[model samples]
Target: MDVTTRIGVVMNGVTGRMGYRQHLLRSVLAIREQGGVPLSDGRRVLLEPVLVGRGATKLRELARRHDVEHWSTDLDTVLGDPRWQVYFDAQLTSVRHKAVVAAIEAGKHLYTEKPVAETARQVVELARLADAAGLRHGVVHDKLFLPGLLKLKRLVDAGFFGRVLSVRGEFGYWVFEGDGQSAQRPSWNYRKQDGGGVVVDMFCHWNYVLENLFGRVRAVTAKAVTHIPRRWDERGEPYEATADDAAYGIFELDGGIIAQVNSSWAVRVHRDELVEFQVDGTEGSAVAGLWGCRVQHRSMTPKPVWNPDVPTTERFRDQWAEVPDNAVFDNGFKAQWEQFIRSVAGDGEHPYDFYAGARGIRLAEAGLRSSAEGRRVELEEIAP
Candidate 1:
């Protein structure tokens, strides 16, 4: 029998939506259900997280729910303890940098949600700090771990799609307006001051997905709009929408593979989910949803005409066929968390290190600047 690696985790922001559902419940406790991650060295990774937050009662409740006896409101005290090897942050985007920097200064491995910082410079600094400290660091780029995206990556690597030409990403859903009679998300999500907005929140996903599956973006031109001028809050009080709800951007990848990403918090879709990606290559094309992937090829191109006046049945409507499922894994977030643990144990490479995460933040910063200036922003222009 092999000994288990004792990992003490400082889990900040465990009471939030993502913190509770994804990190605490699904990733940590759920991974425990599967006997945790088995390392190649015959050691199992055991997570011992100390839930940290300002509210003592909330922290206690969360710790009890997860069967973790360790809890703390003082981040300094937790960081001072050598037992805690990793400091994980799932707090609001704006506060991530300071907390992460403090952890790094304390010589602890670090993992946190995406957008390492609200700005590119902050991300660069964080990257520099991590590198200087020689600590293992990673950011949550969970989309790449999605079963659908992984399938797409495999197909792309296999040349199932000859020379890749273009990619299209569609992401959106109907966000409830905080009218007096409706449920609304936290107000911070909609206010720029609170690090809220669809562009900042989601563009990180698109940046990593594009960089991983397609290529690194060399440039970007974007347009942003605030579709709904006002929305209701949890208090049923209407607040003016100050952030952009929709963003359309064109990305020039390294190899000239052009891609477009459309992100919104205000759109209706009939598809299985609001997030989907379609890639076109020389030999074949593929579309992926949360559940599966569909592929189409030159050999399967539907016979059609270029006449718009013809009936709707005149184009390549049925050319695509679903790619069979081949993955045997848990949720994407959970998988990432498991991998992070392995990486921290020195068993594998840190999945999405600070540099990769900084790149995503840089891309988002570029897009926002481009949208505001109505011009294309070159990746090189933004320092990472």
Candidate 2:
């Protein structure tokens, strides 16, 4: 690698679990240690993250533990610094738009977690602002970078899917209430006032996943509910779950493919993976998760004669083939971070920009609207 060009990034909300583990520990720090992301031109962009968060102890502990030299509690001061060219946010969804807007006004390149804003308007507005300033901006769409999804994309690209039929995605795991065991997630995730809802959170993810893999989500018919009314908080106190813990949705995609996804924090996992998508096409079908993918071709499909009279024994589970990892796979979030930094360095084109993030927010909004109105809402066509 040529002399590495360090890109200083102000990382906020990294004290949180997802932010800390995925963005900081797995992505940024890993990139730094590995001598940065390689560009097509041979040069590399080394990420220098300045850990910023609300809690001083956590920040300090994280900094010391991770050997991060620069850390700050003041976001404004960090953003004002000329040394840092990128401002990254993993903060609460409620405050994300305001922070991103401030970062944009500061004339810095931007990167942040999903659902860039609470509303579609704000998401689009951020994309507009970033475009107007001619600054590089990206939001997390890590699912696309997952190894399983990558393999699935390869199948689609290879014409293995032929004409795609329908997609079914199941994403959920039980989150223990604070009563008997500590809740795995923060209490804010269960409170709507804190911008907590399954539709807003997971639909943003499903948006790009479906769009990129299957097709664009044209319309959505959804039902959302707060499955658990009350849950114990970190303080061992019971609080009303104002947010929807569960959401069941069916999306009408382009090319007449139907997509259905169920997201819930209250459900138990019974599938092979915690989150899985089964894509059934004309010629073949594939089930993909974060790490693994299984495929079954129409030619290899089991044909069992339907007989209600007697129980037939056929090994249906053994019919499909598992997609092997011929190559080492990087962390999903880390992979996206590398691509984003490469794009920032003018090495590659990353189309998953702020506009894509807005589309994600649009899908989320559409799901909420459909659930509320009990009608399928059409997605306003946006540029891919």
Candidate 3:
């Protein structure tokens, strides 16, 4: 007795790069192709997305391209409709709060991209609203679902790395200056007024990674800087890069774990992956990238003597063993989407909700504050 239930969703901000590629194309469409999300009781939840955005032309194009039955430029009308049960947002950080608030008022279960709002206060307010309305709400925690990180978590869970010590993370690559070549990232990413900055964007991610894998973040000391003074926009117009393009942060996690992460858009890549983390512990150590992970256990630890006079002979990089994927890995965004859909259908509670999103925002705020004041900022528990 398998039953397929169609869940209508109002999807806003599909015109943006992340919204279009990851959410619309990869996650939602891929789920539909897979015959929806399966429940334990032989039931399936099929998503029906109604594309909503500011640009009618873009929405119409996307709807037609995806063969979506419904598309709308009028968010109010779409929100007022009782047919749509869920609302998903991948909008800009600056404008996300209002739309999320409206969706909650309309009684739609919420699923959204991180930094749910510009500030911690706003995210807490949204969490309260969703709770009051008795709706399922979730913020994306995609990085945890990454294959490399998943393997890292598996090792941690298996006690492979007994008594974790510290973590070092490196993320980012050079963005072409608009003057010589077109910038890879959006121009707004370098503008502070539009909620742009490496600290605001990356600290949110670092906070969750540290909190989930190691321990909750206790304090943060960060240095944020604008390395490149000016860059060209999409239209080839020159503008001052007012926002910080780079951030070097030291986070103190619970249980005496120290995590250092460097996020930048100005640095050149010298590693296999754009983002990588090296976790050191008492028993073992591991280096994990976006898709690959290598580990060196205590039993196989290599000891080399430092000799500056002669050429180094030890192949340090080749010493670690690669971590294999024990199971098939789904697209991170798609997996999270399925989980959120299940929660909306009363399968179970979504773990990364608005409250979690607020904590990320708080971390970003703390990092920025620390940079501005030249001091360490301690994290305060946010009331759920």
Candidate 4:
């Protein structure tokens, strides 16, 4: 027989797409279905989720639909409860700060979605609060845990990309402008007042990906634009799209590596995946996306002559070899949840802590600043 310890987690903002699909359904419920997370001492830690949100009807429906035992509309009441030891936030960026502050004051361990707060300052403050309160805290860095990126990381660790030179990343897809067609994203995503923009949303992911795999970003030069100026809201009402739908950024890393990434919600993707990164090095180069990775070594690289009147004759994409998935990978959200649960259960601390979250926000702020001023911005150390 195995001993099981049930840990309660206050899950906020599960009504949203990512929150509902990834965090609630795919992660917590899936973890529960799998007989809980196993511990080293032959003990298992089960996650008991208490769904918390502003909408009572929606929360109740979701709770009942998923067979969740606890559901609450009152965050204050939920925070005061001793049963829930962990607080997980996937709320809107604008309102995240206050809710997280309240949760921290309640002495709950924190786990949150990216861009932890609207600004870098708020994230640092939260980090300090969690640190002072002696609470374990972590932020979502799901991209790094993807199988493709995991393989990329393995190659890096094995010195496959010797003397890394540069990295190029493309991420985006066409989002419908709710006029004749319905917008896939919420109307808030097009409004700057709502803390929405490609820079704010995607830069955080890029920052972590770059730093964790390559090096820390030292400086950034970026241009952000609202390609789709006019858009209709969810209610079929016309409104000015105040947020930038597209952003192009060039980052200078600590190791003199240059990384260029283009993020856009208005552009159509031509690649195999929605997001792809090509890392070029002296030894070899690799292109990795959410699910696939292909590599081309320096020795195997093909050379083509540039001619104005000649037709190109090369299977360029097919030249690269596909990387194999040697091991099974769990859902990224679930994996992170398990790790956070283990941390809260007295295991070692989670590496993607509040400080790491702050750094991601710092990069986002820097990118926005660079775009606004039309000048390259250098990253400065932020402290609480």
Compared with the true structure, what per-residue lDDT tens digits does model 4 show for residues 77-159? 99999999999999998899999999999999999998899888889899999999999999999998899999999999999
Give the number of colliding residue pairs in candidate 1. Answer: 1
Pick the winner on TM-score between candidates 2 and 3. 3
Q: Rate the local accuracy (lDDT) of all candidates.
A: 0.84, 0.89, 0.93, 0.92
Sorted by TM-score, highest first, which candidate order results? 3, 4, 2, 1
Residue-level lDDT for 234 in candidate 1: 76
Off by over 4 Å in 4: none
RMSD (Cα, Å) of candidate 2? 1.4
Error in Å for residue 94 of model 3:
1.1
lDDT of 1 by residue, 165-261 (tens): 9998899887878674464467778888888888888888888899888888899999888898898887778888898889999999978899998
Error of 3 at 124 (Å): 0.5
Q: What pairs collide in candidate 1?
A: 178-232
Candidate 3 residue-wise lDDT at 160: 93
Clash number for candidate 3: 0
- Per-residue lDDT of 273-341 in model 2, one digit per residue for the tens? 889999999899999998899999989888789999988687887888999888888898999998888
| lDDT, candidate 3, at 78 | 97
Sort the candidates on lDDT, descending order: 3, 4, 2, 1
| Inter-residue clash pairs, candidate 2 | none
